[model samples]
Target: MKLNRRTVLSGLAAGSAVLAAPMVMAQGAPRVVVVGGGAGGATAARYIAKDSGGAVNVTLIEPTRQYYTCFFSNLYLGGVRDMDGLGHGYGTLAADYGINVVHDWAVGVDRDAKTVALASGATVPYDRLILSPGIDFKDGAVPGWDVSAQSAMPHAYKGGSQTELLKAQILAMPEGGRFAMVAPPNPYRCPPGPYERVSMVAHTLKEINPTAKILIVDPKANFSKQALFEEGWQKHYGGMIERIGPDFGGENVSVNPSEMTLDIDGVVEQVDVCNVIPAQKAGEIAHAAGITEGDWAPVNAADMSSKMDEAIHVLGDAAAQGDMPKSGFSANSQAKVCANAVLGALTDSRVFPAKFSNTCWSLIAPEDGVKVGASYEATEEKIASTGGFISETGEDEATRAQTYQESVGWYAAITSDMFG
Candidate 1:
């Protein structure tokens, strides 16, 4: 159950051999190469492979052997769920779903030849390309934050070594040590992620060091589920967590990791642990392929085809999907819509208009959950939301409990949809 890199790769190898014939057929029959095997890419591969029924070839290219979901990652940090629960293997996508899993990074997109070049020196041509490479941090956005400092103060946004590093830092901190979190500006991946992480860290610190503190330095004055978070912090954690918004002069204007200090306006603050989540843009691959216009790729709402290039379809967090928050659920939902459109395009059939849905859950305590959800429908020009819900600002205890149950059910359903 604890799916790690080695185990997952071994599983893929065994499965690949068994499904070799089907894979060959799939490969030979009108190929589609999907880059990035994270939530969106993996989901697209699975659905296309299933629905195409060996008539369409689906090859998924990703460097990693296993994927770690950002959705429930905060639970892992809180010790509510084991890392095994968050870890997923692509063996089923290859074996049961008949998707060809290529364990290589996509180095180049040759639009002229309609092929993708791998770092391993293999060139896989495709009839169409679906890209969902996710988001990449914007360089120079935070002056002193770079790859080297990432080891000492891990962002944990990418969910691999950074996750382990942050976990270690928290575990190794002395009793009553301070943990400072710098949340990004609006429109980042997992809107509730940083807040959820704060709650989870608070959950851990309360047990290990009751007197320890968490300081959140946010750029925005208000955040997702602000009242609910405050209520939970006051009721259970009891002032262990403190928030500093821009209005309250909580901005981390500058950072110097070598000195272990952050300059907030004119004041200098020091902490045992630091988590800096910076501004972001589309992934490097999309930028290299010339699909991104500014921070994100613009795509046609009807089929996720790039507005810049019809042959390339962009999905997930990297796409500039107006009115759609960049969350794992949103990425997965968009992938399904993209898959259906790709199938229709290849076969020259009518593409069905899709309704997309997303729900993000955050755990402020072990069983307490806060959530925001939305349902969207596509128009001729844009993907527009029809309805949405946020956990009521001042809900009763019973309502909060019901939302928590819904959050748990959603986690189960989403993981099933992805890997089952």
Candidate 2:
């Protein structure tokens, strides 16, 4: 579907009207504070502000003035996309959507006072708080790997500088040089992201250095879209990429940045460039707020409210919900459900049952894209899938081409839903 200005405005109006009618003007409209302005946080802020119709005061705290999506970063690496295309501004969120966007990092959460303390020494109080700060890497998960070492071996998972670093390394690699990737364990952000990175880098390598090879050292035996990715890699990239799972001693156990080598099962593998995606957990803010246990924050799936604190809700990668991959699309879906639930609680309206949907696209080549998606309904205690995985497997050429186009359409649709 084409997403023009008219369509986006219409969708926003309809979504707001439908969700707002139930909570017209009760208890003076609660002050909703949203942390982070990435996919999940931005979507929640926009929807809540629009639905409240100037009743609820919505404040969104994000450190960055703009956002660069990790979803299409591979395309950027492959030279098919540019920075301008991936970067998004938040002007519409402030002006058209009536959201108060604050550019600051949240340092602490005063749950008792119902306020979020910023590093700037400002404390913003909220009647309800939504936290979606995404993931943080677990230090010491990969020995000898840290922020400083990232200059030599980057993990482009967070986008921005790391992405540019990886790009430069690829361009500088000599013919027949090896590009090694240390894939993360399961339950990380974007299950198909690493594979997509390999594909995109391989595409660039095919042109710049035809003999350059890509080696993926993964701890897990299987990954998302395994067969499809393998097929596409072999068919188009001509066996330039090789994946090493645990069975093949492919686990990225450690790293030695000084020597530019990665230790895989006691064997030191040297490479021209390295990308390490380490194990991750909820952002530091969540942990500091006493909202997370272990690597994730536990929450009530029905409304995404924190199990420990009722007034606070956590969504996106920060929250630990079974059966939902930590993806931008999944986070966006969860944000709407949480927003609706928060509106109902504040206005004393009948809360409608929540349903969620997500679709993740991985491009193996310029013209080839594969995806897996599902639809889910929230249960008494958990969110359960109403439908199973819809694969792009066996799709004909015409169908594949259409799906690729649809993927682009989805990007526009989702970005509009989040910020426009």
* Clash counts for all predictions: 0, 0
Task: Candidate 1: list runs displaced more than 4 Å.
Answer: 1-28, 394-398
Compose the digit string of candidate 2's lDDT tens values, residues 163-274: 8889999999987999999999978999999998999999999988999999999999999999888888888898799888999777647888878898888888899999
Q: Which ten residues in a row have the lowest lDDT in candidate 1?
A: 15-24
C-alpha lDDT of residue 185 in model 1: 81
Per-residue lDDT, model 1, residue 70, is 73
lDDT of 1 at 61: 93
RMSD of each: 5.5, 5.5
Error of 1 at 230 (Å): 1.8
Candidate 2 segments exceeding 4 Å error: 1-29, 392-394
In terms of lDDT, model 1 sits at 0.82
| Clash pairs for candidate 1 | none
RMSD of model 1 against the true structure:
5.5
